[model samples]
Target chain A: MIASLRLRAAVVSIVLLAVFLGAWHLATRSTGTAANMSPEYAKLMGMTATQGKSAMPGPLDVGAKLWEHLRRPFYDNGPNDKGLGIQLAFSLGRVMLGYLIAVAIAIPLGFLIGMSPLMSKALDPFIQILKPISPLAWMPLALYTIKDSSLSAIFVIFICSVWPMLINTAFGVASVRKEWINVARTLEVGNFRRAFTVILPAAAPTILTGMRISIGIAWLVIVAAEMLVGGTGIGYFVWNEWNNLSITNVIIAILLIGLVGMVLDQILARVSRLVTFPE
Target chain B: MSIFDDPFDADSRVNAGCICGQHRSPAEHEHAMSALRCEPVVESQEKRYENVVASAVLRAVFPEATTRRAFLKTVGAATALAAVSQFFPLKTATEAFAEAGTPEKKDLKVGFIPITCATPIIMAAPLGFYAKAGLNVEVVKTAGWAVIRDKTINKEYDAAHMLAPMPIAISLGLGAQPIPFTVPAIENINGQGIVLSMKHKDKRDPKDWKGLKFAIPFDYSMHNYLLRYYLAEHGIDPDTDVQLRSVPPPEMVANLRADNIDGFLAPDNICQRAIYDGVGFLHILSKEIWDGHPCCSFAASREFITSAPNSFAALTRAIVDATAYASKAENRKQIAEAIAPANYINAPVTVLEQVLTGTYADGLGGVKTDPKRVDFDPFPWQSFAVWMLTQMKRWGQIKGDVDYKAVAEQIYLATDTRKVMIEMGLTPPKDSYKSFSVMGKSFDPTKPDDYVASFKIKKAS
Candidate 1:
């Protein structure tokens, strides 16, 4: 019965995907003719017009382009041009560095603030004000002060990712069961030892959840930051393709960004699952 | 600060604390250091820079192009003029190709927007001009003009492709931080067009575009100034009569298609792109407005020029040489082929071919051939910079009085270009201050203030 349920869901997902792709294919198929176009322009825009293809790329075009990208993912032609894999790797490298920095800062500060009611109350307003700011707003200031675009991009990723993890870690640490903490106190376990053994385990799942969210955000910010900075990354690839007016390459980049982001989320989700414990 | 504050004075040249690198006395390098493992290459490169300086100084010194450096008095003046290039961090950096002058830095990054105007700059790589000059140059296509500006300013790029007016604007601090940007060579001339949406194919007159929205690549661009000049000449005030927004060139065509903008004064390929897509029509080329007007240029931060003079020289010479090659009509198709690769402009060969060859569809069902439609002349004229200053003042981008000549000399490095022209056996007009008419009205560069005052439908500064 369980196997049947899995099979049915898979079938439904396949049907939905097929329907989506089919609609996209039909909608973006060539639209207008080059019938009344200028003679010289007509010659240059031959297939793009005479074949009545829409200026926007179709699903098939994206699929073919994506296939091309997937086949050779690490070719580096020059400083401006690199394979999709290389770009993704650059993006992931930046994200991981920034995300780890956030994790390093957030978890400790979050723990100290959560352990003390005074600190939490004092920091709440600042956190509240800072959390809602868009990451890119810091770009100009980062670039001007840091004097480095790539470092500025990484800083943007760090700023956007830190707050969520910090808030979540604080909330998780603060909400740890009072009874379990009291028992640890009753046993007179040392403050540091008791906390690591008792409270840390209790808040592990929640902290992991916070970490998962931060990774998601870090991934999101890197694309936009790379686009702004324009060096080497998935965002740069999308922008470069857009400049080339190659919608096919942009679509392919978009797809790969999604794929990498999903993989990142799934990895964090798996880590969080490992930390979860039932009473 | 007074607008006439003369940021570039003679006293400042001797004592200025610039980040590019300080120059040693000319005699220090003359003896050839024990470190000169490659003295001959360095000396030759120095000779090249000297020729460029001599030619450029010769321009500043004489009105005629043929006054050779042989006349004793002229030669002494030329030596002094060449010495002027030394106090400034340009010549010696180019002289040494070995351990001493070995590019202070190799593996240089250059940024550019993917337009046909950037062909000479982009093609230099595949054509191996940079390599031939002992440079490992990597030219990356940038997202937009703003990013190129930022990346170059941030020191992320050693140099960049910019609109001719952008270096002037940056130096004057019109839109960003006040940094000394140098335009050593103009990349292309007359490569822009006014592209109107398809709906306005019949409404081609400038007077008729009273209420339409228009897009220009940047505020500090020849496109914006040219469009404004063209509009004002037609009695339409650009500011109030029509909307002009700074949109990236790639997005301009899309905006036109979406009816977001009625038209754009943009670089080639974008204009051709619109007509190719059947979404717009080419109304008129910028060349028609002012033939041989400088468009985009090869610009660098003053810091980069001083720090890596040799690399900068090699890069500029490569670009100038490339521009010389691109200027010839016979080699244009092959030049077009070289730049149309995926790593370069990434445009369809036909579009680039049309832009380079000057045979294009008018988007009005007519095939027109205008051979000088988009010309590539590398010399950066001081007068062009002066013209840009006037527009900035005319539009109120710059306030108070301007030391136009001093600013032009500082920003426009016409002297560097003199050598490249000599290398190619071409004589750059020593005094390239040639005046030209725009929209049937003559502009005297010497009287920029009068020119600005003459415009009727101006921004009311």
Candidate 2:
């Protein structure tokens, strides 16, 4: 029965893949011909006519180009050297580094503010002021201050990642059960032991949710930051391909970004699951 | 000595027992011990002397190794490697010949906004200029300059008819990816104008551009930069003296009409449309402010330029030829008719012809005609580029000192441009540089490097 189920799942996945590719192929072919049928297209198409040669390349021509690039994808073009793998790795590394830094700074701050009314009053104004500012708005200042594109991009990711995590962490820490604290006090537990043993475990699930949100924000900011800064990153790849006027390549880049983002979120989801108590 | 007499003595019973196995006379044993000690000491001394001599020989033979000789060898090897790498890149570019050879990537898509400067591109497409150059060009209509820049950088289009500064700004990585860009050909020059709303007629005259609220289109846009530069020349601070707001190009006329903005800088065609509608009047033509200023050009990726040199050259020739044709009086009507597609500006033939011909009725009953209004001379405008670099420095768009000559050399490919001009029987100017005296300050293009260095501008240290 298990073997049959596995076989059925495999067949379903294969069929889905075939259907997706078939739809893509048909859509591109139809659009390609329609675009060429216009008068403007005819004028442009006339430019490439050699006595017997075809002027405009059809969808097959672009597909061939795509296949050619896919075959040897590790080739380095110039100073922005590295394959797509290396570029994605660089981008992912920046995202994680920035996300971790943000969490490290935000969590403790959130805890302190959440625990004390006075502390919350002091920090609330600043948080409210900063939360509404877009990540793109911070790019110019970051670029000027940091003087390095890679670090600027990382800093942008950090700025974007911190807010949701901080808010969530504060809410998580503040909403801890009053009964648990009373239980710890009756047991005559020390403050440090009580805080770690009772408060932390109670807040773990919420804090993990905040971390998941932070990671997703980091991933989103990194792409825009990389595009603005320019270097070996997935964002740069998208911008570079777009500048070359390759629409198919742009689609490919968008797909890569989406796939990578999904994987990152899934990883965070798994991590959160491992830490949190089952419902 | 006896063992019981002195337990710590050298001649104790334990010592005597040790010497009992190989017993010899006292004088002979002493002599053997002395010989063994001296032999080792002599051998060690000899080894030390040999080491010193060997080190001295090595030092003497290769005295210059630490200095000049090693340095020269390293430099020579580096130079050779650099030369080889420069000559042979990874991907061999396909040659783009006008008369022959297949276009490497033929189904070309280009993007442009409806600006007067891009009139030639609109004209060229319908007239088969791009086709003649072996480009299957598709002109994608963009919303505005920002969208055009975004789309161009994103690779939605192969090339673009863009503001001259767009490519430069993008290449320098001001706010976007440092895409390598080059203007293969100049599209048109001196089509932009500054206009004032009718509400300003009582407060300010047409000549007084400084006393009004200047509605700039976008930050870091050419219109904003140029307006700021023009204001500064007249001793007006754009920040303190007047309120500057960011408004889109399509809304510039409406904003002025609604009295929301006092004045705005826009292209000639749009300003003329507003004047014809009796909403606003021409304050000053930016062309008059800086005559023969390089405004817009046909920009392409550096990758495209390198990959398809022949195609680039062909495209340049086509643009140059088209510029010549469009400038002639006989071809003016035909050029206007060709560009009248609804997807383009959708303006009547008369409006396009008047703007293209540089004949403007100043909206105050006066007509001004300048024959050489928009000079298409590619080489002499290196001064304008230098001027722009200086302005960029002044406005904090660029930081640190760039080698102005090198930047000019990269952006302005005089050799290729001039070669195309010569083939067309046009006299390509021998002198590369020109001098401009703007607001009584003389800027010599020949001394561009020194000129940029001497400017009192805030630069990144």
Candidate 3:
């Protein structure tokens, strides 16, 4: 029954995508005659426009551009114009660096916060205050104080990603089964050993859940952050294409961003699954 | 100082001939030696240490044991140099300019808002001017005019493509954190246009623009001031009669199409782009408002100039060279191609060509060629700065009696710019304060207060 449901869901997704593309194509058809404007203006409008209306691209235009980008994703013409692969690498490199930093600081600090009531109580107000702020709000302050745009971008990601993991790890550790700690205590398992063996295994699933949440939030924030910073990233690429009024390139970037985000989420989900056990 | 060439004495280092060794004539030596100034001259002279660039190039070029010596000894330095020149142009290139004291900082990032007014600043990178001057410079495409100013202020950018009015505003601490900024050279002149949406093509006169929405690149930009002046001269109050918003040059066309703005007085290729897309029509070239009006400028902070003078000089040399190269009508098309890639302006090649080549469709069915339609003369005149100050005063941007000449002379690096202009073989004007006319009204630098007070349709002062 589940397998049938999965197959049906896949079919439905395909149908929806096809319908969307068909609608897009139908909606953007050239409605105006081609001869009203001068030859000069017509040439400047590219293939999208015939008359005076916008050449906001259809699916066909995006698909062709997407294919072009995929064929040569690593071409580096210069500093300002890099291929999609290079741009993605720049964004991913920033994200991973920021994410790893968050992990290193979060997990250990979160363990302390969860283990000790005093630490958790002390840190709670700060986390509550900081968590709700939009990541891009921190951008100008970071750029000003840090005096480095790239590092500031990374710093924003780290600040934004740290909160969820920290909260979850704390929650997971605090809610561990009491019997596991008692058992370890009775057997003369050292404090470090108890944490590494019993508490860790019990809390692993919840901690992984937090990490997954953080990764999703991190990916979302990076696009906005890079767009605001405007250097080299998928966000910059999208903003740049928009500046040039290339809606086709923007569509391609959006598709790639969604695809990359899904891959990131899936990898985190896989890791979460690896640590999960039956009740 | 030892006048004699004592080979055994360590103080004397072989009165080094020009690296090419072909031009040791008295005239050539005079030319080369005049370029090499005395010690403690430009910014990078104080590593207080070694000649790292030359040694590094030598080490990288000849890594083999004793190969540099062997090449100099056996193969005869000239032939070896001839072979090396194909790869690195060692024989022909000016080594002085490369090593010119040492760059205190090499890898520099110059910020620029993506607009064709920044042609010289942007084209210099792709055309190898920066590299030729022994600097590894990256032209960072900034999102807006405000960001460019901020980045330059925060030291994130070594220099920036600023509006000619910006450094003056920045130095005065108007609408920004007070940082002493200096304009080394103007980037482009007379490259803006008043473009209206296609709906208003018939509404050609400024009087028809009452309650019409308009956009300018920045308030501190010549675009805004010129637009204001043009409107006021036609008895239209820009403040009340029409609306003006500051949109980035890239978004001007889209805004026009979206009906967000009825028109804009903005930098190219934005004006050209609007004409190209059929969304907007070119109403008037900005040169019609004020011929030889200054636009974008290559600006650096006082901190940058004071700390890295040689680097500053080298970078300015590259910019002046580029500006001189761009000033010529013949080179405009190739410059358009050079900066048309995705990395730079990212506009269509045809759009860039039309803007640069000065032959563009007026977006109203007629092709026009005003050869000086858009130009690149990088002279940062003191009088231009004074005119901007008066405009700034004319608008409510700066209040309180401002001393025009002192501020203009300080911010506009006319003397330094003159030195560079002369070095590049383009003769700068004899006096930095030359008068110019705007809309049939002549502006005298001696009386800015009179100029500001002469305006009737001003914001209530």
- Clashes by residue pair, model 3: A81-B343, B43-B309, B43-B310
lDDT of each: 0.79, 0.62, 0.81
Q: Report the error of model 1 at residue A7, Å.
A: 2.4
Better of 1 and 3 by lDDT: 3
**Model 3 agreement with the true structure over A1-279: per-residue lDDT tens digits:** 999999999999999999999999988867666656667656654443346344778888788888999999999977778999999999999999999999999998889899998989998999999998999789888877887778888999999999999999999999998988988899999999988898888888999899999998889989998887888999999889888889899989988899999999999899989999998
Cα lDDT tens digits for candidate 3, B34-117: 322111112232121122233334557877535666555666645654555567644323444345567788899999878888
- Residue range with the least summed lDDT across 10 consecutive positions in model 2 chain B: B1-10
* TM-score of only chain B in every candidate structure: 0.78, 0.71, 0.79
Which lDDT value does model 3 have at A113? 93
My TM-score estimates for the predictions, one after another, are 0.85, 0.49, 0.83
Docking quality band of candidate 1, CAPRI definitions: acceptable
Off by over 4 Å in 1: A31-41, B1-103, B423-425
lDDT of 1 at B138: 86
| Segments of candidate 3 deviating more than 4 angstroms | A38-54, A116-122, A177-194, B1-107, B131-134
Best by TM-score: 1
Candidate 2 per-residue C-alpha lDDT over A1-279 given as tens digits, one digit per residue, 9 for 90 to 100: 999999999999999978877765665442222322334223222122112222223446556755865677666643333467677888889998899899998898777777777877788889989876777888877765665556777899888889888887788878888888889999999988876888777887788898888888888888887766555687866655443223456666676789989998898899888878764
Greater DockQ among 1 and 3 belongs to: 1
Q: Which is the winner by lDDT between candidate 1 and candidate 2? A: 1
Interface RMSD for each predicted structure: 2.3, 16.0, 2.3
lDDT of 1 by residue, B1-461 (tens): 11111212223233323222121333433322211111111123345444454444445654443343234234465455555566554455344321234566778888888899998889889988777667888898877787788889988889999999999989988789899999989898898999998898779778888889999999989999999999988889999999999999889877887889999999999998887676788889998898878899999999998888978877877787677677778879998898887678878888888889988877666778988888887778888999999999888899989998899989998777665445433445556565767777887889988988887776665
